[model samples]
Every structure is written in structure tokens, then in C-alpha cells.
Target chain A: MKAATPTGANIALFLAGLLFGLGLAVSGMINPAKVIGFLDLAGAWDPTLILVMGGGLALTLPAFHFILKRPAPLYGQKFHLPTLTQIDGKLIAGASLFGVGWGIAGFCPGPALAALVTLNSSVLLFVAAMLAGMALHRLLLE
Target chain B: MENFTPITGLIGGLLIGCAAVLTLWASGRIAGISGILSGLLFPHKTDTGWRALFIGGILIGAACFAWFNGGVTIEIQTSPGLTVIAGLLVGFGTRLGSGCTSGHGICGIGRLSRRSFTATATFMFVAIVTVYLTRHVLGGNL
Candidate 1:
């Protein structure tokens, strides 16, 4: 009868981001050229990154199916999966913004944050600005 | 989509996916990056296990990426200032939108949440179009 717990969920999310960043780094998806290549419709279009993502998806589907049916999870009390289903303007806007940022920087948040390990000023600046962005949003209560 | 035998790809995906499922099972919460982040920011909630684990996991995972890849071959092509700014934008978007791609796209869509479907679809579209504009129209001049 306690309130909701998010320990497992948080770890899952962090790991997901970490692994995602790692996949980008290991598979070379973090490389701007590779990402741009994916976006490039007229060029050589190296689809190797796509393969990485596809592989990940393949592995993900089956496991989730089996896991969701269990009565009680290991970390919390109930499943907190969302139930809404529809496409809308919010989706379009957010995706557009995310894409623009990704295309321009060649660094998604997880990767960008991870990329900070390189110790380059540019990376640091980006991380700082990212933090600033978060702060600004928080201040505004958005 | 076929002839893919990279154990790294499958195993990595399975591990991350399993982690997400388990966290959901244990915490009774979706492994949404945005929500976790918001919780950290807003501070009304009491649970913090998942958040700590998630952040820690990201750091460890990033190191693992470098380790597995013999030192993640990273190059900084952009200015740090610009990158930070980009991060801010993403943070802002994440806040305004109420969730990040992980929450909406992965967990939300998986659970068939209408809000998540819309959010995920929107995020994707926004990402795609934004990339197009920034790279194509704006020329990513930043």
C-alpha cells in the first residue's frame, strides 16, 4: 500500500540511455557522417546504423512480450505503462526539434553527454548549454 | 533486416530491453527519461533510487562503451558553446512536451498509450523535419 516506486524504472531508463549512447559510440552511430548519411537521400547512404537499430529492435520485441504478463515486477508494485494512442501536433513539433538538434550537433543528449568524456571544450560547452537549457525550462516551470 | 549476426547488437538490445522491462515490473512505472528527469527537477516525489541508478548506469555504461570500443573514437566538430545550447533546447523540448523519446516512443507506445503514441509520433516527425530544416534550409550554419 505504499506509493509508487521508480527505482527500477530510473535504472532502466539510465541504462537504456547509456546503452543507446554506447551503441552509437561502438557502432559508430555517434559519428556525424554516419548520422548524416542516414539522413542523406542522395548519397552512398551507408545503412549500417540502420542495421544496428534494427538489431536492437529485434531483440527488444520478444522480451517485452514475456515480461509484461507477469503478476508483480521485481522492483515496484504495478506496471506504469502509458495507454494513450494517437498522433498529434505535439509529436510533430517535438520530433522536428529533436531532429534539428541531432542533425546540427551530431550529438544526441545521451551521446552528447557521453561524448563529454573526450574532454573537448566544444563538448563541455554543449553540455553546459544543455544544462542551462534544462535550468531555463525548470525556472519557467515547463 | 536479415543476415545480422553481431552478438553485440542483439545482446546489447536484449540487455537494455530486459532492464527496461524489469524496472517497469519492479517499479510499476514506465522507464520514461522525461518523467524521471522531471521528477528530479520538480522534487515533489520521494523515490530516488531509479534516478540515482540510472545516472550511475549511464556513466558506467559510457565507460564500457569506450572500453569495448578500445576508446570510443570521438571527434569534436562543433563548438562547445553551440553544443551546450543544443542541449538546452532539447531539455526545453523534453520539459514542454512532458516526456522524452524513451518514455513516449519505447514504453508508452509499447503499452499502447494514446498520449505516448501521439508523443512518440510527434517527437519522430519533429526530429526528422528539424534535421531537414537545420541541415537543408538553415544549412546548420550554427
Candidate 2:
């Protein structure tokens, strides 16, 4: 009657994103100025973001353990796990670039889009840059 | 929306994480965000049903939140054209990196995948450094 956990997975992912977005909105993390302020430790640093992240982690950890104990999942057919190791230039380079982009914009793609709903100028810019970044990566890869 | 009392992040994370696990268990998929998005980007002939539905679900979810919560507070601090460009760039970057934060950090790392772990770590490092450079070095706190 049902396909796979796409229903659940998709729903979950969407909901998760919603929550993530909501967090940004509520915590004011979506604001580049606030984010920059947090980063600006030497100046007026606002560490509220740490609390938001911590709260998310707290909720996720227990759920993660509970789900893992199950032999299988209801929506998904198999446990989607990964198996790989080793760090290289791609890893370092990607991270650095991502950080730089994030720093400049104070908005990652996820949060940036969420912030877009707010109709802020900085968020808009960051989102534009992010999409461009994604396109460029695709060309180079494929 | 601003009036809504935010749920404890722990609760939100729980709901989201369980949904992710269930999807993996049911679909035999890794909950790789990039993969799902990439699918949308490069659609295959036979993948219309679930894939389309999935994409629909994402949009629906966002809309639902905005509607039910009285629409989110959109803060467009930047230009519309630029934001779109950023999104494109992110799309490219995810493709290049083979995964997004969700895939690498949550799904991949959860399963002890070396690649995911490395990727997640790299991404985090980059994000941190970017914050420093933008807020401290360049002072582009728009």
C-alpha cells in the first residue's frame, strides 16, 4: 500500500526544515546583524545561538538513540548509513569556502532561505550567492 | 507567528530526528538532502511519482507553516536577484561536495561513515572560519 519512507522522510525533512527555519526566525539567528554580533565576540557578542543549537541537539540525541534501537524503520526499507573515512583537499577546501561564504553573508542556505521570508536585504543577498555557488559546483562536478 | 511560543528545541529535534530515522528505515535511503535536491535538478524518467511528491511536500510544509503561523516574518536585507544567485551557488556546491549538511552531518556521520564525518567536519570548520573572516576581518556585517 505504501512505497517507502519517502512519505515519512519527506515529511520529516520538511518538518525538520520548518523547525530549523523557525529556530532561525525565533532566535533571531536569521538576522545577519545578530549573527555578525555573535561572531563579533570582541564587540557586543550575543551567544543566544549556542542555546538554540544546544536545544536542537538535546532533542535530536534521544530521538536518534530510540530510532536506532528499532530493527527497521516503518517508512524506510533499510537503515541509510554511511561507511567512509579519510580527509583530503576537497574536504578542507569545501569547508573553508563554505565558512567564508557563511561569514560574509551571516546566512547559510537553509537559514538564508528562511530569513528570506523575513524580506531582509542581507538574507536576500546571501541566498543569491548561495544558489550561484550551488550552480557553479554542479558545472564543475557534472 | 512571533506570538507563537517556540517549542523546546529538544522536542523539535526529537520529532525531526525520528522522522529522518523512519525514512531511512522505510525507504532504504540515507536521508541525503543533496541527493534529494539533486534528483529534482536532474530528474530521471521513472522518478516522477515519489520525487515530485517529495518536492511538493517540502513546499507544502513551508507554506503550511507560514499560513498557520500567520506567515513568517520575511526580512530581505539584500537584493532579490542576488539571493537567487546564492541559492544557485549552493545547489552547485552540494553537487560538488556530494552531500549537504544534513546528509553528511546527520545521516552519514550517524552511520559512522568516514566520508560523511570528514565532510561534516570540513563543512563545520569552514563555517567557523567564514564567520571569523566576515565579521572580524572584512567587517561585512550587513
Q: What is the C-alpha lDDT of each candidate?
A: 0.57, 0.53
User: For residues A1-142, what per-residue lDDT tens digits would candidate 2 score against the true structure?
Assistant: 4343355655555554454444445555545555545555555656654454445445444555666777766655655554335666665566455544444445554445555554555655565556556656656766
The digit string of per-residue lDDT tens for model 2 on B52-133 reads 4543444444455566668654433434553454355455555556666556655665555677667766765665665566
- Candidate 2 chain A TM is 0.81
Which stretch of 10 consecutive residues in model 1 chain A shows the poorest summed lDDT?
A41-50
Interface RMSD of each: 4.2, 5.0
RMSD of each: 4.2, 5.0
Question: Is model 1 an incorrect, acceptable, medium or high docking prediction?
Answer: acceptable
lDDT of 1 by residue, A54-111 (tens): 5544544565566678876666566655443455565556555655555556655555
DockQ of each: 0.39, 0.29
- Positional deviation of A136 in candidate 2, in angstroms? 3.1
